[model samples]
Target: MKKITLLSLLAAFVISCADKSQAPGAAPVPLLPVATVTNENTITDSEYPASIQGKVDVEIRPQVSGNLDRVLVDEGAYVSKGQTLFKINERPFREQLNNALASLHGAEAALINAQLEVDKLTPLVQNKVVSDYQLKLAKSSYRIAASNIEQSKAMVASAKINLGYTNVTAPVSGYIGRLPKKQGSLVSASDMEPLTTLSDVHEVVAYFSLSETDFINFKSHYAGKTIGDKINHLPPVSLILADNNAYPQKGKIDMVDGQFDKTTGAITLRATFPNANGTLRSGNTGKIRLGINHDNAILVPQSATVEMQDKIFVFTLNKENKVSKMPITVIGKSGVNYLISEGVKSGDQIVLSGIDKLQEGQLIQPEKSAPKVAQIINKK
Candidate 1:
């Protein structure tokens, strides 16, 4: 009876195993949202940290030593070229000028006397009353007097220049910076600091740098053998101001450094922008936006990528609808997309959703998807 009961229990366990195998819930294929890769022209934009400066920058310093008698223009004023911005005490310069003039007048009187002596002796020598040697000595005296008058004239011209220096004027049209010296402050040519600075902001320049590798890559994209030709072919760039707003006018790359900086291993680049509204100034910080046009390029949504062990990968669906984790090389980043340089080609489909649940060689149900990738990338 015990043997019969044991046989019946064994039969029941076998039936249970058979039932489980015949059931419909073995392993489920996960349904995933996917995006189809397409070939298209994409203009990828990149931004670099930049410092802005006015086209012209001038330091306002005293050309001659003097007390600042009057501040003709206040700080932060818009000054035109040759406009008097500061007035030094003219009394001292005027007195020096008068002294120079007096010396010149005395030299001129001496010259007149010398000329009178020469004129008086010329006829006497002609008539043989005075010897030719004596007449020659009188003419020589007159020439010496004329030379003295020339030296005095030079002194007068120098004094005039010095007097003109008392009235400090703007060297170029621009906005004035801080004024270190007020009306009572004394300034001189040898002072370590400048009185003020002027910046011409009719146009502005943005300076930026690129790493050696990046510079090489940057030059490779443009069509040219020489750097000048490359620069000429370069398209216009854009500037983002400090306030995070795009400037109204587009700028061009005006200059490129001939060599890389030894210390930084980076090359400098400059772009110029028109400042019609006087918004940009020297010492302003901003960003320079450079663009590259890719023809028939393959782009992948960043959401489709998975990072593991310091590498990037995406799950590509095969003809059988089975997923295989494929590696990809990202050369650049755009708004929510990776500018794929290697690993994946055009027309490849990649999983865009349910990446966490994905596994190597996993079978999945793919759904056509257009994710909010750009929206997500921009927010980040």
Candidate 2:
């Protein structure tokens, strides 16, 4: 009887413990995934690839005809106005000038002899020793000699100008390119061959085109906002070359095309940048950026949204702490983010991660996750 009572007491204790373990409403509710909401209105900037260019470029050519005796400046050399760039062989030009001078001297001597003959004949004709026809002939001879002297003087002047042309000088201040014709090569004035190229790069101009649609949209959106004025005060422009890592200087818009292009349906634009350091070269390819306006929209991290069957969706946390799957519309995609246009508000808590095991209407505990900080790259 004692053994049966002990066994019954032990059995009752085990049953009591099992019943306590299965008590009502004691299971812990699991937490669901979550994320904070953000408004797309705050991010209203964009960037594009632009090019660097110069406002002025010129080609240098020789004006005189001769053998290129010497080149005064090397390729890629900075030069000033009236700077001598080349020296043509002046021997031939000097010889022509000397011949003209000799001709003038001979004509002057002839004129002196003819004048003396005319004076002697005039006295003879007045004294009735020579005929009137003889005096007239002497006078005509004197006039012809004088005309010859004048013609020779004019020829000398022409020769001197041609000789001066042998020394070629720069017409403007700028950097020069390589010589097209090497030294000892013959060049002509009629051909006017390009000897080198010079460009004024101190203030460079950038050339680019914009679509007609974008141009019209900008004009309509921003009234009284002239294209030139819109980009004028923003910031100095920058250039990114094909190989260069960064732009060397800041620049600004200098000109916008007065007329739109009819063929391409685009408008041409230009921006000027300071190249005091000579870092920017003409004919270089690079990128340009211009800022427009700000707008209100929706933005969300790519991870928070899941794509199923070509449809985008996000798991959102409701006020009841219940997980709900919401369908969303994406307006634009930039980098690793999506700009949402519908289905989410600024203050809603959306799930960023840990959504693979969640089910609809499942009772659970909610755990708050820390908001993710984003690095904003300003596009101006």
Q: What is the C-alpha lDDT of each candidate?
A: 0.86, 0.75
Alpha carbon RMSD to native, model 2? 6.6
Q: Give the TM-score of candidate 1.
A: 0.87
Candidate 2: what lDDT?
Answer: 0.75
Candidate 2 on 340-374: residue-level lDDT in tens?
77888778877666766666754556556455313
For model 1, state the Cα shift of residue 197 in Å.
0.6
True-structure Cα RMSD, model 1: 4.5
Clashing residue pairs, backbone N/CA/C < 3 A, model 2 = 35-350, 50-286, 50-287, 50-288, 51-286, 51-287, 54-205, 236-251, 237-251
Using TM-score as the measure, the top candidate is 1
Per-residue lDDT, model 2, residue 165, is: 90
Error of 1 at 241 (Å): 3.5
Poorly placed runs, candidate 2 (over 4 Å): 1-51, 99-158, 189-193, 221-235, 295-317, 321-380
* TM values, all candidates: 0.87, 0.65
Per residue, candidate 1 scores C-alpha lDDT tens digits across 1-380 of: 99999999999999999999998876877777776676766778888999999999989899999898998887788989999999988888888889989989998998999999999998998899979998889889889889989998998899899999998999899999998888899899999999899999999999999998889878888999999999999999999888888888999998999889999999999999999789888999989989987887777777779888888998988988989999999878766788888877767778877887788888888775544333333454
Residue 152 of model 2: what lDDT? 100
Q: Give Cα distance to truth, residue 217, candidate 1, Å.
A: 1.3
